[model samples]
Target: MKTDDPTMLAAHDWDFPVPIAYGPGRLAEMGRRCIELGIRNPLIVTDRGSRDLPFIGQLQSLLENEGLSATIFSDISPNPVDSEIGLGRKAFRAGGHDAVIAIGGGSAMDGGKAICLTANNDHDLWAFEFEQPVPVIGQGENFPALITIPTTAGTGAETESTAMVTHADKGMKFCVWHPDLKPALALLDPELTVGLPRTLTAWTGADALVHAIEAYLVPGFNPLCDGLALEGLALIAKWLPVAVDEPQNLTARGGMLVGSSLAGIAFLKGLGMVHAISHMVGAEFNTQHGLTNAILLPVVLRFNLPGQEEKVRRMAQAMDLSDTSVEGFIAAVETMLDQTEIPKSLGEIGVPADCAARIADKALKDSAARTNPRVATQAEVQAMIEKAIAHAR
Candidate 1:
């Protein structure tokens, strides 16, 4: 791996940061953290599916014991739309919440973050959509304090400063960005993820791996992110299967939770075509995000290998591949996927062939495309999609 290409190393800017309270029993400090952030009346934002969880009840009780009044806002969907954020803002205003306590998976966490911001604003949320030649997040200095408690080990939404909210009219997932959108604190408790279903374990774990891989492969000069991504990949490779196989294994769960957060930090440099394509497909077909990334990763790896051979070689070494070639690295990924019983193709996950062109068109316009090592055309992305569909397991 040569480091002569300064072009590949250039980056707009760089930062390595996040405030996290991480451990197996870290949820115990959630209310205390909220109180420290001046949240007397906190809005608990989560998806409907998680509202009934025993932990939710426990969390409410804990807040009550801490002399905090809490309101439950679980009206978000798996892929939260802007309208849902609007509804959540209404809920926040009606409840007169002073702060937000976002809990649950990526969807719930992202929706909560958006809801927290929108609660005090009277303008449309779409005004914040990340546009190129400009920053991803627009100018917004005012926002309520937020604390995130992730119930899943993927999506890294808890660790990022961006939110992916669907625009109902556009029917596409758009990112809302703000430096202030980052939660003041993140609590990572492996116990929260111990009960994740096997299917979700594989899906979200794969999503975490994709985040690391794409971040490593994306052309950038952020060595800190690159290092984090590599370590994250190694952690996922070693621990994801253990987690999926033995759901109650705290060590594996904790490794995955840390790996997922590290991956989130890594992608702050940028993500590549895997995310671009995955976001489009997820918005269109209502597919699971991690599943889509898992299915598309191999194909995107192959697509990105032309000018990125050295980076892929480094990734192979990081993944501990016996064969350091691109093909060998991809083969190792396939074996890992097979071991986890993750489906091999987009079609297997209910993505339609007819939507490939549209997905490709949208993917080319995605913010992630700007960082991809391989500059892909719409036709090339479409061909990759076709190959991914044809190769579905």
Candidate 2:
């Protein structure tokens, strides 16, 4: 296969920057990876809910057996805020840890990434935000060596170089992007996801779908990322329901795990309105990330329909929907949401109509909002929020 041949384009530009090992029980090798990375003392950053799980206990024991003392920082919350990052940073520094082992969902992984950055940087995390022509964080600076183990099959935080941390006082999500934030290694072990609740499985799986769909429809369609986005979409369409309905289905879990990682890689090209709108809804309402994406997905698809009709038609075919029309594609997504038992509206998740404008304004300013197929004006964004609010009602 010629490297530049169109047939090989996907494989050529598709770069898996971090080493990712995928399989059942692959997490058991995390300690070995840590050793290879020269980590003597590693801090496992995770949420409190995951600490009691047998898988997490097993990881801890594995580290202990390797003569590496692993400290647990399970104080992170669902929408991890700056305070959580600060606390995690303090814990990391005090423990004299050499590396970070992020374990769990997006929140835990993001928290771990933030702590790693703060541990090595002199400036505060928020100071690294990109503004206008100035780039956030200098180039080529190395943070702590980081390893990631995702317990959920969504968020793909393990593969990305960005972290979304909620503001301390504003109650809005802010992202910190830097090459240094990417994990040194990622382990995708489906066994760690077997204990995920049906609701969580559906929510996170939907998030993965949104990532792939939005990345595919976003303005810049890099051939490499488009292939990944489409493949990820197909996997989620086929496996998410099975994983949600049958918690013990390792095959479904494995597919979702791989799909999530692919979606993360796809988003490197760009993401669309679904993420921009969902981020606002999530931060303002404290809704689950995947659930928020699922709720706003069809609405964003409809809003971008005029420009993305062909893409939606192709997506409809990929999802195996009978209808190829834009509306048909939207309906298919809605159907998937219904099958997964995801909420249909923002109101269902406690987002008030009065707060819609504020969320819309913030969304318009988000970096993800810039890459949307149709660049949303403030009025257009506000209208989308109203539509979302009405849909929820």
Query: How many clashes in candidate 2?
Result: 1
What's the TM-score of each model vs. the native? 0.92, 0.92
Worst 10 residues of 1 by lDDT: 5-14
Q: Model 2 over residues 1-393: C-alpha lDDT tens digits?
A: 111212211111123767777777666676687889898899999987787888778989999888999989988888788888899889988998888998999888888888887875566778756432323454544577888889999898787657888886887787776754667788888878989999999999999999999889877539888888888898788888888988987878888888888888889887777788887777777788888888888788877877677787777777777898887787778888999998777777787889877888889878888888887788888888887777832
Q: Which residue pairs clash within candidate 1?
A: none
Could you report the Cα RMSD, in angstroms, for every candidate shown? 6.6, 5.2
Distance (Å) between predicted and true CA of 90, model 2? 1.0
Write the residue-wise lDDT of candidate 1 on 1-393 in tens digits. Answer: 121222212221122365777777777777787778888998999998899998899899889989999989999888888889998999988988888888999899889988876777765687667772323333543677888888888887776658898888887888877665667888888888999999999999999999999999887588999999999898788788888988988878888888898898899899999999888888878888888899898898888876677887888887778798888888889888888888878888888788889889998888998899888898999999988887843
